[model samples]
Target chain A: EPEVTQTPSHQVTQMGQEVILRCVPISNHLYFYWYRQILGQKVEFLVSFYNNEISEKSEIFDDQFSVERPDGSNFTLKIRSTKLEDSAMYFCATRGQGRETQYFGPGTRLLVL
Target chain B: GESVGLHLPTLSVQEGDNSIINCAYSNSASDYFIWYKQESGKGPQFIIDIRSNMDKRQGQRVTVLLNKTVKHLSLQIAATQPGDSAVYFCAENIGTGGSYIPTFGRGTSLIVHP
Candidate 1:
C-alpha cells in the first residue's frame, strides 16, 4: 500500500533557530495535513493544505508556522524562531480526493533545545 | 471547545481475548469517525472507520460500532494478539463542505499479554 513519507526522521535545533520539515504525500492524494503530538498529550491539528493554499488552520498555527507544496509531490512545514515548547513529534498526512481518511506518515520527531 | 475523548486510559487483555476501546465526541456536527493505532514512537495507523450514516462496520478481525444518538464509538478487536498492544485513538471529523479536519481523542492504551 502506498503511504506518506517524511524526511529527516529526527530533527534537533537550538532555540531561535529555523526548521523545515518535509513530506512527500501519496502521488494521487490531493489533500495534505500537518499535526503535532506533544509528549503525553493528544495529537493536535496544525494546518491543512489543498490546491496550493491553506484550507484550514488551528489557533496553534501562528505566525511562526507556514506550509508549502513546493512541488507536485513535496509538502514542507517551516517553523521560524523555534521555542523550547516547540519540541514534539510532527506528523504529515494525506488523503485522496473524495476520501475523508487521512493516512499518516511515520512522523518527524522535532527536538527544540 | 468540542473534542473527541476516550473513556479509559488503559485496558489489559489476555492473548486470544477480545478487546473493546470506547470513545466519546462532544461535536454533534461530526459526520465521519476513524480509529487509529499508535505504537510507541510511531504515528497513528488507520484501523477502521465508520460514517455517521452507518451503525456498524467490520474489517478483518476488527469491528467498529457507532451510536450516533449518544455520540459514542467503539472498536472491537477479536482474538487480540500481543501485537495488538498499542494506544488506540478515535478521531472525529469536525469540518464540513469538503474540508475535513479530524480532532483526535486522547487515546486508550491496550495491553495484550500472551
Candidate 2:
C-alpha cells in the first residue's frame, strides 16, 4: 500500500513569485507525471518525466514550468512566475515498471493571489 | 485533441444499492483505461483498469466494462455504502510506443445516502 507523498499540502503565494511543489513517489516507480485541475474543470496533464528527462508535455506546460528529480527520490515541479490563473490543485502520479496503473498523491493545492 | 467525458455530472443512490457510472472517449487510439475515485481534499485513487484487448475486469466490489467499438466505459459498484460517495473520473491513455500519459475526464459526483 505504498503511496505517493507530496509536501506543503496547501500553499498560497502572491502573483509573480516562484513556487516549487515537491513529491516523493513510490521507491520503485520509474515514470512520474504532473497534472493540475482548476476548480471546476477536468484534470489536465502538465508533464511526464522518465530517465531524468522530460518525456512529453502539454501546451500548458510552457516556459514557466520545469520538473526535476534532483535527488532521485524528490520529484519537484517549479513555476518560475505564478499567475492568478495558476491557482489550482497540482497532483503527482507515478507508475512502476511493467505497470499501466498510475498512482496519485493527495495533491498540493496552490493558490495565487 | 483527445478527450474523455462522463455521461452524467452527478448520481445519487441509497446505501446498499448498486451504482453505475458511465464514460465516453473520443480517442480511438487509446488502448488503456482507468477509473479513479477522488474524495474531497484528496487526489484520484485507482479503482480499476481495463485494456483495449479486454472487455471487462473486476476488482473487489467494483467492476469495469469497456466497449471498444462504441468507445464507452462504465464502472459498477455493488452494495454501495455512504463511504463510496466521491467524484469518479475515467482516464484514457494511448499506450502505444512509450507514452503512457493519461487524459482524464470531467468527474461524476456520486452521492450515497444512508
Candidate 3:
C-alpha cells in the first residue's frame, strides 16, 4: 500500500515566477513520471525519468520545464517561468521495475496568476 | 495523433446497480491498458489492467473486458455503491522496448445515487 507523496498540495504564483514541485516516490520504484491535467481536459504526459536522467518528454515539456531526482528519493519538477496557461494539477507517478502499472500521487495543484 | 478516448462523458446509476464504462483507442501498437479512478481533486488511482494478450480480467467486484479486434475496452462494476462515484479514465501504453508512456482518455464520470 505504499503510495507516492507530493508536497504543497496547492500553490499560487504570479506569472514569470519560478516554481518547484516536489514528489517522494515509493522506495523501490525505478521509473518516475510527471503528468498534468488542465481543468476539464485529459491527463497529459510531461516527462519520464529513469536512471537519473530524462528518458523521454513530450512536446509540452519545453525549455521552461525540467525534472530532477536530486537525492534518489525526491523527484522534482521545476518551471522556470510560469504562465497563465500553466495553471493545472501536476501529478507525480512511479512504477517498479518490470511493472507496467503506474501509481499516482495525490497531486500538487499549481495556479499561475 | 493516436489517443485513448471514452465513449461517454457521464453515466448515472442507482446504488446496487451494475455500471459499465467504455473506452476506445486509436493506437494499434498499444499492448497494455489500464483503468483508473479519480475522485474530485485527487490523482488517478489504479483499479485494474488488462494486457493485449488477455480478453478479460476480473478484480474484486470489477471486471475488465478487452476486445483487441475492435480496439475497445470496458470496465464493469458489480453492485455499484455511492462510494463508487468518480471519474474513470482508460489509458493505453505503447511499449517501446524501454520506457512506455500512457495516453489517457478524457474520462467518464460515474455518478451513483443511493
Best by DockQ: 2
What are the per-residue Cα lDDT tens digits for candidate 1 across A54-108?
A: 9999999999999998867799999989999999999999989998889999999
What candidate 1 keeps of the native contacts, as a fraction, is 0.71
Each candidate structure's TM-score, on Cα atoms with residue i matched to residue i, is 0.98, 0.98, 0.98
lDDT of 1 by residue, B50-80 (tens): 9999999999999999999999999999999
**What is the per-residue lDDT of model 2 for residues A48-94, given as tens digits with 9 covering 90 to 100?**
99899999999999999999999989999999999999999999999
Docking class of 1: high
Count of backbone collisions in candidate 1? 0
In order, the B-chain TM-scores come to: 0.96, 0.96, 0.97
* DockQ for all candidate structures vs. native: 0.84, 0.89, 0.88
lDDT of 2: 0.94
> Candidate 3's error at A51, in angstroms?
0.6
Model 3 quality (TM-score): 0.98
Report lDDT (Cα) of residue B27, candidate 3: 95
Go through the candidates in order and give each one's C-alpha lDDT.
Answer: 0.94, 0.94, 0.95
What DockQ does candidate 3 have relative to the true complex? Answer: 0.88
Per residue, candidate 3 scores C-alpha lDDT tens digits across A12-72 of: 9999999999999999999999999999999999999999999999999999999998888
Off by over 4 Å in 3: none
